[model samples]
Target chain A: MIAEKLVQTYKVSFDQNNQELALAGSMRPQRAAEMADCVKLLETSLASIRGTFYVNVKRLVRLNNVAFHSLAGALLKAAEERPDIKITIITSSVIGWSTKKFGTLTAKNPKIVVEEYDSEFYPGQAFLEEGGFVPVLRTQTKLTWKHERAILPRHGLEPGMTMADICCGIGDFAVLVAKEFSPSRIVALDHSKSSLAYARQVASEFDIGGIEYIYGDAAEMLLEDGQFDFVSCRHALQIFNKPEMIVNELVRICKPGGRVYVTNEKISQCLGEPRGPSIEWTYEQLSKLFADFDMDLEFGPKSYQALQRAGLEDLRIESFMVTNRDGDAQAFADMIMAWEEMFAGGMSEKRGDDAAFVEKFRRGFEDHIAAALHPGGYAGWPVWVASGRKPR
Target chain B: MDLGAGQTEAGEFTLLLEFDMDMAGFTSNWSYCDRLSTYFARMISHNRSDSLLYSNLFSSALNELLETVYRLHAPTGSFVCSVSRNGAKDRIALTIPVDTETEGFYRDAVVVLNGGDVSPRYHNALFSDGPLQPNIGLLELAVDYAACFSIEPADGNAIRLIAELTLEASAP
Candidate 1:
């Protein structure tokens, strides 16, 4: 073959402070000579670090033999030259080949360790997935679905459209969509293995088929470009520090004429009657609590601007308030109680909130639950849903 | 029938994918290896336990073989890559028009693949300086992916190269 040089689609950066060399994107250079500059940079990065040089390849999707050979040479050379230093390669299990490809190096040098960065990625959310959160999440989806089932059509979801649900949590919404919309195909992906396991169990238990639940990271997915007709990332943007990266991936995998949809919460806007002030104060504190974890409880309103900035056209945006009166009053009350435990019981303690502040925070959720069950009172949680079409 | 280099009749196999093009067309650009492997991997990996993971591995394994053929094939003939399945085993068979020397290279590669242990040889070839060992890709498939290799006679001036793989282990 002649003239087989592929386009340079990878980026290499050295963070001197952390002693990290980060590589991202597809790397399939035809010759080892093509990677000379990168190898030189790696050699230079190694000389300055005294110990534990980090190589982060979490977003590196495609790597070929020519490039791997060059990378291995430089790394193994560093091990030989610097006897005291340890080289750690951090790979993402989401990328699939990362751990396997990099793990091979450990056999050659004990100090050259490969670690898959997963399981503990979310700061305060692992506890929820470990046990109690799954049923609550399913109930949460049950409550939200009542509003979303109608709202989705307004946001460009229709029957027979190929769909993908990214960061799909317990995957209840994907199942709901599969049953209602009959999408040609539905690929539901989430980062949590336990959540995906539960999702698969739910799907299997119900004898539901045509929904493929996969384990993957939302920020960096291996899905092909323009594969889906409608792609949705619901209630995920609020939890991520940088939602734009996930937004870009959502838009990328969508066909040019297809649409990208997302849902996020404005937690501070949650309202309850009869002791409304107490509920208001607690939610405001809840926003601050999430802020400490690098999450935005106020991301719902910002969904419009996020989709607009993603270069999408024909945008549709709206907000829905799910109230106790929408369906079963007890279900809504139960959700608030779970939130009280999650936020006040778990997060508030982590932030070291004092007994006095914690008592007041707990009071607000209790009041919201009281309002939900009052028969005369109202409790509400607001969510914003947005969709934008990729330019044709 | 020479039956050399672990060569044997594959018996009947169910075809999953097959690509045939003029040798010049297939080898005109090297990106064909990447594109073809990626497409084939994606198309077939959907039903696997972990579709993304399976595709990533299958693509890598196939790309190495495709690259080897792209590098070492003869000047003119048809290049054929066919994929088949026998239960859990996935088979990749490539028919390449080769000269006597290239045919010898394939013969010896299968021998080295079936040869006792190839991990050290694979590592040595990977870190070696100057030109790569022409059989390095075969060794990697054997050592890294645990692929079983076989060779067979084809039409005039051509040889069939086959690799059998059981990539994913059973889930616990």
Candidate 2:
């Protein structure tokens, strides 16, 4: 009878894509017969199964109102029968229709939950320029021991050595490195006092000691010259208004024979974007802003040029391709959110709420990443760690 | 068996599936495509009389060719599958839009089809020597499925791969 119903209406069948059950094909006419038939098929298939079921309807292009109801009913019935089963339906946040429809459908069923993901959904609150640091526009930090182990060894930080982390926005990298590298004292400075307070709280929570969190201008720190055995800045160089002045401070604070490491990621180099309406324009504005700061756009392996220009020796520059296996799209989405905040007038003037801007760039990122990682996708970005020793 | 004057047309018929190639992702999960081709072959072969041994071999051959295509390409472009009929013969074509470099590489392959092997010689100003690595998928179709296939350049950085399968008429 269900097969007969499918014959009368549109064809729908289930296929397995890894852990998820993918239901593909079109559903039209919005008739109850077709809806009932689909429900019956789902019930039969799910009655014997237990535990969580991840059903993805992304491939199903069209579904009538009644079909949504039928799907909801079938999912609810399955959940009620098992009592332990959890049903999660992943959908696009941009589609208002699906949001409302799925919302209404899952309203009564406690077991059924609809999860919406959009690359542009900035999780953190957007804060306008405060000490040249904005928390809302920040991407997830690479602060793990793996990233630390990559850059810290070159510095040869002894246990009693002092280090300075200038422009330490949230102090994540500095804290992680301080704990792992066993430095005697590490002073982390940032322009944003609020960010410094938060970073201090995080450091205290981690019980990391022998560190001081200071709120000050990096380019004009009062610290004595050659006081720090090692000086490093991670990822926040491009945001500085005068990177050259700050680099001078980084060099000034470092002792002779001590190491100065300036590492940054070239976002554009790693995250390829497919040409879309707003992609070129958004990046163009960001580039202009970066130019104003004298920040090198190509800041990875080529970063040594800046340090070399500052008169550092034994310069070693290594560029790595850091693949985003777990959260590639989300990280890129956050990057767009940051750009949107940084250029609010330019971005919002074109599209209010940054949804359109986010969607265009986010989709471009997804598509580019998909194509790059296709046939099988290892999504990644380029990270350059350039370290040079001060003249001995 | 009464074979009436069959209809022969030149124009195209219906299009089947259109898929985008994600080469990196597919390199690891290639079995999915293999399974898909076999499933599609079974679906298309339904309700057809398989009195001749070649019919079963033909379906298997088509599945093999589809799987081979899945393994070779990076799957970054659009893959279009369309079908057209000429009298008793049905031709299924899979067209993929590829970059110029890839198209050049494809042009130099040594292909074996219909139990006969042929190496297509190409004369290019850039590289006087012809390319290598035969289009093995096409060769399998010709050998096992008794199908005639060809790989030729299409519009705007794309190549067309077409295979013709002739079906025997049933008893009247």
Candidate 3:
């Protein structure tokens, strides 16, 4: 069965002050076909907005032939509905596929225009995973003894060594490695420029040196081979689009005999699992849901095997548990909410009805929190800490 | 409607607040940013029902603008934020200037916002420029929370952002 349109797949807004109506997201056929509905919804929300309506297709990675027609037709309807409105479609140079249609779509209506923009990274993969984590949350996790042991000496990190922290969200691990091991050189690389800047700020507070920050994709880093003595990425493997490729890339950049550490959650180990209502969902569930629907999730647990496949020796996996006491029910709720918010978009494919599914998950998660708050109750989950050595 | 900072008139359809600061003041102090967001959130929650849409929009718009400012903050640039209402519409405007070196980065962001390209691809590409951070504020300010918004370039090296909320039924 064809899935329903993904909720929040695209967002439309009309800024009256600026006289602009903006649309952003991948214009899939389902969403594009509902253009009139979108127009109706916006009009219902705020009828006063009328002027330049811009649809930025730079991030709209793929538009089916039908989607192009649907979107163009919708905008024409919008323009006709309100003769005062001009429709503009902004596209990226990388999206050569949709530009020609946009040009033809708007050629007849002077009210519509196509603008092309050049961006270093548009319509690209997520560079900053987990939405650039909170510094406090990151530091709290890092300050743990077990985390330190897994990442530090156990991973063979030491002074005078060169290292790379791949997908280094906010570079907290890089800052820690730089501070504790005093590496000769450390490269903090992530797709998020803001996280890197924060990482730089954190690193600056310490007397660290030889730390360079690079903003680029993990799958395709511009670093030289054998450049670092060790490489590490934490809490980001499962969410990566291509875990094996990233693992191979990590292996490629590490000096022979250097160590590589990758950490991620085994969905089955997350707190509130096995106890919450059957409605409780994990990110892994979303992936499976999409798979069942014949769609690609491109996210899941892939650390240990990928490392071994990269030919790293002495591969090992250590599991650590994070638990919350009855007193920490609120904290538990926050955690569940964060996870739901992050992965909800993926669940859209499997949603029977957007609101009901969302409400079910939300209410069920809340009930689980209430259960956790019961006398002597506790919630915990396991984290897979894995490492291997690059062959010389 | 006298839409000035800190102006509150009883029985009026709207209230207005304005703020102006430099990059150093806005980014150098986290408390300041937090206070600004909290104020916007509190004002709407206090003055109206807990369901006021503009309240959340203001919070999201301010946070988004602040994140961008941190990424492209100039040593001596300015930051301007305004929250006003014209009849049934509540509006917010944020403007910040970037350092010359980072102007290209800020410009690209403006392009994405103006184009209404908020896909992960566009955002990831825009943010890939390590220097980008997560816009949790903007994420929280999803389209469900606001009527409309836009991003564009302003005078000099600054970027101007605006978010609007229409309160026809909810107007007092």
State candidate 2's TM-score: 0.40
The better-scoring model by DockQ among 1 and 2 is: 1
Model 1 spans > 4 angstroms off: A1-9, A13-20, A43-53, A82-86, A224-227, A354-360, B1-13, B73-77, B86-88, B98-101, B155-157, B170-172
CAPRI band for model 1? acceptable
Cα lDDT over the full model 1? 0.86
DockQ, structure candidate 2: 0.01
Candidate 2, A322-360: lDDT as tens digits: 554443554544544455445444333433435675555
Arranged by DockQ with the best first, the candidates are 1, 3, 2
Best by lDDT: 1
Tell how far residue A58 is off in model 3, in angstroms.
19
lDDT on C-alpha atoms for all candidate structures: 0.86, 0.54, 0.56
True lDDT of residue B163, candidate 3: 65
* Per-model DockQ: 0.27, 0.01, 0.02
TM, every model: 0.86, 0.40, 0.44
**Residue A164 CA error for candidate 2 (Å)?**
0.7
User: TM-score of chain A, model 1?
Assistant: 0.90
Best-matching candidate per TM-score: 1
